[model samples]
Target: MHRSLFNILSGRNTRQGLWGLPLLVALLISLWLTVETTQFATAENLFNLVAQAMPLIIAAIGQLVVVLIGGLDLSVGSVISFTTAVLALDQPAIVLIPAVFLLAALIGLINGLAITRFNVHPIIATLSTQYIVLGITRILRPVSGGTVPEIVIAAVSGSFLGIPYPVFWGIVVIVAAWKLLYGSRYGLHLFAIGGGIASGAESAARNFGVSDRRNIILAYMVCSCFAAVAGVFLAGRIVSGDPNVGLLFELDTVTAVALGGTQLSGGIGSLHGTVIGALVMALLANGMNLANVSPFVQTAIKGGILLAVVGLQSRKKMGL
Candidate 1:
C-alpha cells in the first residue's frame, strides 16, 4: 500500500512540475497585460501579436529539431537573411522558393557534413557557415530595399477563411512537426541519435534504423528549409528584405528551445513543448512592448530569465 501510494504521489508531482513553465508564462503574460493599458487586448493588437510571432516561432521550431540531435544551427539567422534577399531579388515561381530552400538545405547539409565527417563541433561548423552565407547574401543584394509583390502582401496580411495566415502557418507546421516527432520512424531515430551516436546506432541497428549521420544532416536541412520559409514571411511583414534582418534571431531561437526543457547537452524534448515555449516568448515580447518596457531592459530581462530557467533545469536533471 505504501509503495502504491508513493508511486501515485510521485506521478502527480511530476505532472505538476511538467506544467511549471507554461503556467509561469501564462501568469507573466497576464500580469504584464493587466498592468498595461486597457487597450492591450483589442482584437487588432492580438492579431498584430500573432503576426509578429510567425517568424520567430517558425525559426525557433527549426532550431528545436537541430538541438534535439545534440547539435546547433547558428547559421539560421543568416539563412533567413539570405533567403529573404533571394525572394526580394524576385524570380519566377519555379525558380524562386525551391531554389532558395535547396540552397539553404545544401548549406545546412554542408554544416552537418562538417560536424559528422570532419568532426568539427556544431557551434564552430555552423558559425563558419553563418559567415559564408552572410557573405553570399551581401554580395547578391547589398542594398536592403526590395519590392513587395501584391500576392504575398495579400497572403500574409490577409486571413484565409477567417484565420490569420501566420497563425495558420504556425499551426500547420506545428501539426506536421507533431506527426513527424510522434508518428514516424525518423522521429524515433531523432531521440535515439541524441542518446550518443554509437550507442544509439548499435542498439537500433538491428532494425536498420535511421543513419545517425543522415539524421544529423536531415536535422540541419529541415532547419534551413524552415528558416527559408520564415524569411519569406518576415519579408512580407516588413515589406522588404532588410539586410540587417534576422539579427539576433539565433539567440531567441536557442532560448526558446532551452526554456522548452530540451537539454543543451541534447537528446530530449517534444515538439509540442518547444512550440509552447516559443509562444511564451512571443507573448513576453509582445506584452513587454505593449507595456512600454525599454528594449534594452527587455533584452536584459530575457537573458536573465534564460539563465534562471537553464540553471533550474540543470538542477532538476541532477536531482534525477
Candidate 2:
C-alpha cells in the first residue's frame, strides 16, 4: 500500500512539474472565464479568440526560432510594419505579394548576415534594422490607407465550416514547429546552438558536421518570414496598411515566448508552450474586455501576471 501510494504521488508530482504546465493554466483560465461570463465559452467567441491569437502566435513562433539560437529580433515589429505598408501600395496582387515577401526575406537575410558574418550583436543589429525599416515604411505610405485584395482578406480572415482560417493556420504552424523541434536532427542542432551544448559538451558536433553560423542564419530567416506572414494577415484583416499597425508587437511576442517557458538566455523551451502562452494572453485580453476592464488596467494586469509566472518558473528551476 505504501509503494502504491508513493507511485500515485510521484505521478501527480510529475504532471504538476510538466513543461506543458502553462497550457493547463490557460485551460483553467478559460474555464474560469466561462464560469464568469456566458459568452466566454460560446463557439463563436472561442473561434474569434483563436483567430485573433493567430498573428500573435505567428510572431511568437518567429521569436521562438531566434531565441532558440540565443538571438533576438527586435525588428520583427518593424518588419511587420514595413510589410503592411508595402502591401498597402496600389499594386497587382500577383506582383505585390511576391515582391513584399521577397523584400521581407531579404531583410531577414541581412539581419542574419549582419549577426553571423559581420559579428554584430543580435539585439543591436535587429534594432538598427528596425529603425531603418520603420523609416522606409514612413516613406512608402505615410498614410494608413491602402487596399488589400478582397479575396485575399476573405480567405485569411473568413471561416471554413464554422472554423476560422487563422485558427487552422495556427494549428498548422504549431504542428510543423513541434515536428521540426522534437522530431528531427536539425531541431536538435538548433537546441544545441541555443543551449551552448555545441560549444561545450557536444564540442565535436562542430567538427563532425554542425554549423552554428548556418543554423543562426536559418533561424533569423525563419523569424523574419514568419513575421512577414503575420504582416500579410494583418493587412488582409484590416484591408489596409498602417505603419503603426504592429507597434510593440515584439514585446507581445517576447512576452508570450517567455511566458511559454522559453528562456531568454536560450537553450530550453517548447513551441507548444509558446502557443499556450499566446492563447493565455489572448484569453486574458478577451476576458478583460468582457468584464469591461480599462485597457491601461489590462496592460498592468498582464505585466503582473507575466512577472508572477516568471517568478514561479524561476523558483521551480531553483528547486524551491
> Of the candidates shown, which would achieve the greatest lDDT relative to the real structure?
2
RMSD of each: 4.2, 4.3
Q: In candidate 1, how many clashes are counted?
A: 0
What stretches of model 1 exceed 4 Å from their correct place? 1-20, 197-209, 315-320
After superposing candidate 2, which stretches have Cα over 4 Å from the reference? Answer: 1-18, 197-208, 305-320
Error of 1 at 203 (Å): 8.4
Local error of candidate 2 at 148, Å? 0.7
* Count of backbone collisions within predicted model 2: 0
Candidate 1 TM-score over all chains jointly: 0.87
Please, what is the whole-model Cα lDDT of each candidate in the order they appear? 0.75, 0.79
Error of 1 at 317 (Å): 11
Candidate 2 clashing pairs, residues 3+ apart or interchain: none
TM-scores for every predicted model: 0.87, 0.86
